[model samples]
Target: MSPDQAQAQGRLHDTDPVGIIDIGSNSVRLVVYERLTRSPTVLFNEKVLAGLGRGVGVTNRLADDSVERALAALRRFRFLATQAGAETLYVLATAAAREAENGPDFIREVQKITGAKVEVLSGRDEAERSAYGIISGIWRANGIAGDLGGGSLELVDVRGEEIGDGRTYPLGGLRLQDAAEDSVRKAEKIAADALDGCSLLDGGAGRAFYAIGGTWRSLARLYMFETGYPLKVMHHFAIPAGEALDFCRKVAREDLAGFEHIDVISRSRRALLPYGAAVMEQIIRRAQPTEVVMSALGVREGHLYKLLSKKERARDPLIAASEELAILRSRSPRHAGELADWTGRLFEVLEVEESADERRLRTAACLLADIGWRAHPDYRGEQSLNIIAHAAFIGIDHPGRAYLALANFYRHVGLIEEELSPWIRKLATTRLMERARILGSAFRVAYLISAAMPGVMPKTTVRRRNGELVLELPKDIADLDGERLRKRFSQLGRLMELSADVEIA
Candidate 1:
C-alpha cells in the first residue's frame, strides 16, 4: 500500500529518527526530531548565524567568510546528526544558494564535506512548502504566508491543505537592505512596488498574514516583551494589523529601545529586525491582513510535514502529543485514556454544555493529568502547569494553552484555597476559568477513587437526578474513599451550582 493509504489504515509506524538541515541566508540550523508523529517533538535543535546572505546582493556570491563559517557549522552538524542516530538527513539550501553566482561551487563543497546532497529550493517551492507548514501547524488557517529570509521572501496564498498563487521577491532582509541602500522609506517603496504586481494577493483584507522566519519571530518577541503578554509562546501569537503596523514602523527605524525582553534576542538577529518589520509593514498595508500571526514552523517543518501521509496529517496534534506524554510519564497510558472518558461523566452530571472545542481540551487534560507524578509531590501541579502552558503544542491557541495547563494543575491540586498564576488567569476567559476549576476538582475526586490505577476509573459513574448531582463510587473501591474525596466532590458540585453527594455502593 502507498504511504498515505497505510497511514489512513493505521499501519504506518514512524518511530525512526529524521534530521533536517536548513541553510538559509542568515543562519544554518539543524533539527532532530524524535519521530514523525502528528506533533513531532524536537530531540535536539541548534543553529549558527553564518550570514551567508550578507553582501550577496553586491557580490553576486556567498561571502567568503560566511562560506567558511557555514562549512565549519555544516561539518559539526553532520557529526551531530550522526551521533544523534538520525537514519536519514535532508539538507535544504534556500535563497543564498539558489541566487548567488558561486552557489553551485558552494553546494559541491558542502556535499563533499557533509556527504549529504543539497537541494536548492526555487522561490515557488519555498513559498508552497512554507504554506504547507502553516497548514500542518494550525487547525484552520487561510491567508497569505510570508517567509522572510536573509536573501529572499516567499509569499503564497494558503487555505487549509491547499496552496496556490506563490511568488518570490528580493524583499528579504539582506537583499532589501541592499536594494534600498539601508533607507527605510526606500525599502518601503520597493516593497510596495514589488507587492503591487501580485494581483493574486488583493483580497487578503481582513484575513490572516502568517509571518514565518527568524527576524519576524524576533519582532514578535519584541512585541510580546513590550506588551507584557503573559503567554510567551510564539507559535500562534497574533496581533491586529493596525497595532502590528505601528510596531513594525517603529522597529523598522531601529527604535526598539525600552522593550523589557529585548536582551533575550540575539544581537545578530536584532540587526535584521528592521528589514523584517519593513517588509511586514508594506504587506499589511497593501494586503490589509486583519491580523499578523507569527508561525514557528517554516521551510524545514514544511519538508517534514510534506512527507506525512494524508491520514497522519489528519490526526489531531494535541491528542498525539498528550498521548505521547502519557506514555512517557504517566503510570499507564490505559489509565489516562480511562480518565479521559470518566471525566465526560463528571461533566455530564454537571449539566455543562461543552462545545466541541471544550470536549477536545478536556480529553487532552485527561491524558496529561497524571504525567506530573515524577516531579516532587509538592510541586507536580506547578511543574505540570509550566510544562503544559509552554509546551510546543499546535492546534491550540494561548487561551487553550492556559486551559490545559490549569486543568492539569487542578488535577494535581484540588481547587480549594488554590489559585492559578495571574498571567495564566488572564489567558483564560471567566467561563473557561470556571470550567478549568471544575475539571480540576473533578479530576481530584476521580484520582481519589481510582488511586491512579488502571481499569478502576471505568467503574465511576456520575448522574444528575431530581436536580441533584450524584457521584457513585464502585462498591469494590469503597474503602479508598475519604474526606478529601468527599471535599473534592463537593468542590466540583459547587462549581456547577449543584449540591454534592457521593454514594459508596
Candidate 2:
C-alpha cells in the first residue's frame, strides 16, 4: 500500500474495528464496526438469508442445504472480517442453533471456520441481549423488547437500565409459517396460542413495545413508504398501538403482492411478512402497548454493549456520536466544545426555558455545527442538512434529528423558512422550530467572532442587562467585531425579542 494509505490504516487501527458474525435462523450477517463506542459506526456489513431453521419445528434438525449455505457465508465473513482489520470477532448463534438437534455440530463447524468461540445463547440470554441493544440505542428505554427472528421470539421487559427476565416463544416467522402450513389464518391462531396468557407482556400495557429483527424492520420500512413519511430513518420510528394493530391485521390477512409499496421489501422476505405481521398483531392485541417503536440495533449491538465499563455505559450516546463527528469533520473539535458551552450560558442569561432533553439536543447541534464547512459555500446548508438528517445516529427520535439538521442548515444559510423544506419542518414541533432558528442565529454570530477558533469564544460572554441583549467582547478581540457580526447578533436578538448591543469589555 502507498504511504498515505498505510497512514490512514494506522489511524483506523487506533479506533479498533470489531466484527460480529450473527448466526440467526433466517440469515447469517457479518457486521464490522468502526469501533465499539456507544454509537458504533459500521465499517462493513453484509448478510445472506440461509433459512437455517426452515423445518426445525418438525424435523428437529437444521436442513442440510441450509447448513451448507450458512457455512459458505461464514467462510466469506471470516475472510472479510480479517480484510476489514477486525482484530476481535464475536460469533453469536440464536434460537436455531440452540434448538436444532445438530446445533452443537453446526456450531463446531462454525468455530473451526471462523477461528472464534461461538456463543449459543439460551432463550433468556437472547432476550436480555436484545433488550440491552434497545437500551444502548434508545434513551431510557421502557416496556417490552421483542426480537422476532426466524426461529423464535424473545421478549423481555426493560425500564431504564433495568432488564427483567425474558421469555422465548416459537412464534418466529419461519417457524410460525411452517407450523401453520403458510396459511395466514393458521399463522394467526398459532401466534395467539403461543402468546396467550404470557405474563411477560403484562407490564407493557400503556408503554412502548420495541420491535427488533429484519422482518419487523421490513414491516416498518413498508409503513414508512406507505405513509409517505418524510424521513426514511428506521430507528425510533413509532406507530400508535391502534394504528399498528390495524396495519398488522391488514398485512397478515391481505395479499402481499397487492400492496402498493410491497416492492420496497425484498422478495425473499415477502413470504414471511404475513407470519411476522400475525405475531406482531397478536402482541399488540394482547399487550395493548401505547405504541410500537422499531429498533435497528439487535443481538449484535447488545452483545457489544455488554462489554463496556460502567463509566462508558453511562455516557449519552447522542453526545458521544456528535463529538466523534466533530473530531473527524469539524475545523476544530475544541471550538465545537467551546461553542456548546457558550450557547448554553447564553440560553441561561436569556432565560430560555429548555428541558433536559432539549438541552442535550442543542449541545449535539453545536458539536455538529461546522461539519459542512468544506462543502461549496453555496451548497453547504443543503449538504449539512442532508447529512445530519440521514446520519446513522441513535438515542434520538425523528423530531430530534430534524432539530439538529435544521439548526445547522440555518447556521449556514441564515434563518429563513422559505429555503427550508416543508417535509423537514413537518417532523419538528413549532416550539422546536423556533428554538432551532435561535441556535442557528447564535452559531452565525459565534463563527464570525471566533473564526471557528477555540480561544475567543471562551473569553466572550453574552448577557441580558436592562432590557437589552449585550455581547461583551474582551478588549483584545474587540477589533474582531464588525458590521456582519452586529447583523448576526441582531438576528439572534430578534429571535429572543430583545434589543442587541456589542460592548468592548
| Residue 95 accuracy (lDDT) in model 1 | 94
TM per prediction = 0.93, 0.98
Overlapping backbone residue pairs in candidate 1 total 0
How many angstroms is residue 53 displaced in model 1 relative to the true structure, after the best TM-score fit? 1.8
Q: Give the per-residue lDDT of model 1 (tens digit) for 37-71.
A: 77878878999999999888998989899999999
Residue 154 lDDT in model 2?
95
Q: Name the candidate that leads on lDDT.
A: 2
Worst ten in a row by lDDT for model 1: 4-13
Per-residue lDDT over 199-273 for candidate 2, one digit per residue giving the tens place of the 0 to 100 score: 988888999999999999999899889889999999999999998899999999888878899999999999999
C-alpha RMSD of candidate 2: 1.4
